[model samples]
Target: MIGEREVLTRAQLMAGGLSRRGLVRALNEGVIVRARRDQYVSAAAPSAVVQAVRIGGRVTCLSLLQLLGVFVFANDVVHVHIPRGASRLRSPESVAKPLGARGRRRARLHWWPLSATPPAHSACTGIVDALAHAVRCQPPRQAIATLDSALNKGLIGFADVEDLFALLPRKYRVLRSLIDGRAQAGTETLMRLMVRGLGHEAVPQVHFARFGFVDLVVDGWLVVECDSRAFHSDWAQQVKDRARDLELAKLGYVTLRFTAAQILHQPDDVLAALRGMLGAGRRKPPPRN
Candidate 1:
């Protein structure tokens, strides 16, 4: 059952059956969880964060991600994002301070106001929250991949990203670039990242008449394909890929295919192969423009 959003003002409580003291008394008796002086939740409600949002503060970032099952590896504290100019979120004094082994700077605080928020998806506010957080923390490529997964998993939508891109400041252009860099995850984006990491100026998702879709192509000489079991598991697709490789080779292109496990687990090997190809190509004279 959805909890109530009717926050009781001090005056409203006086007019209702309960007095200020009675409200406090009810809280102490485990009848309600007080999120703020005026905000209270039923004892049977689901989570403190939901109660906080219903009380007026916006839940965002890792807090939202955790609520939506995004598998955040770290960050256990709940983050509450309040609108700017709203009174400070009324958490217990202990919660307001940073959490630590001995109370040092450990727990994170998310007080920044988002000018706007997209609609929720059965508590999938976590996707938007994680996207906002990802912009700041990254090897940009990984963040892009995670965002793609969030979208593929139905955690967020394209409209939400467009809205966010429009809302973020002019100074954050790089974030917009990263957010738009990879539209699909699984293998396509992972290949782009590995190619870039290897210092190859590879164009991603290159379409060739004979090869269908090559994952990355460098100067029309080297074609790299990223294979993931989820997409390339079928024997037919493997055969098609091999036939395409031969066709591409006949057309004067060298094909190098790498599996997802190889790109992710043994990155240096992938880089070395790409570097070798680029170095070999550079040894030849450049074609006239």
Candidate 2:
């Protein structure tokens, strides 16, 4: 039978009650496509997953996270996990051609042993293995954000995160303290890190009466919202955002809104602006009793 990612070996199909003739008929009907010598993928499998299997690897790291709707920062290439001793691998685009040096740049390859066995017919690695690889693949803050995204989405639990850290080298263990599952988005995690880097407490998803959850509150006064096109693109959403800002302003909260692009791409500039804003002598209002 086809696995979660819709990849199956010919033997698996045969064992799953498909007669030889049925298998042939299914292939002829385009129900499945031959991925390699012995591997077959369902027609519905994602192209990236199919390509990863074609490249002689499992889909993993940022690539798999993106497919699962987890936040990944600037993932421009497919991340493939090749076994430590893999050889004669093919390019993702071709089954017969070798994965030469040029093909290497087209995909990010993690040459390592899997932490655990994945589903027999799955084209992707298990979540823990993928997270371990993801941590190594990303920078420290972004790695935390990636882990936070996974935890926030309930893809993995705190114990799984601890296991992921155990799989990593010793230095990465320190990042465990920084993982916050409450982060609603990667941009929020990034901004929170920036604020924390400035020695400020960045409380996430703070709620005020009549104003839903704000993305972050710095020092109990400054509100930071990470605006993504998915939720804040239309004029209607913008108007609602403005109204929220105005309502919070009435309660003595100053809101700073940053686009996903600015937070992800212009991080240094964002940090500088945040530092200046926080340092400009703005007074905090009295705490509500």
Per-residue lDDT tens digits for candidate 1, residues 127-214, read 5554675545445556566565566667678887776556545655564554433334445566666666656556766676543667
Poorly placed runs, candidate 1 (over 4 Å): 1-110, 118-122, 126-130, 146-172, 175-183, 197-199, 283-289
Model 2 segments more than 4 A misplaced: 1-4
Which of the numbered candidates is closest to the native, going by highest lDDT?
2
Error of 1 at 207 (Å): 1.7
- Cα misplacement distance, residue 56 of candidate 1 (Å): 11
Tell me the lDDT of model 1 at 164: 58
- Candidate 2 versus truth, CA RMSD in Å, comes to 1.7
Question: How many steric clashes between backbone atoms does each model show?
Answer: 3, 0
Residue pairs with backbone overlap in model 1: 61-129, 64-126, 65-126
Error of 2 at 44 (Å): 1.3
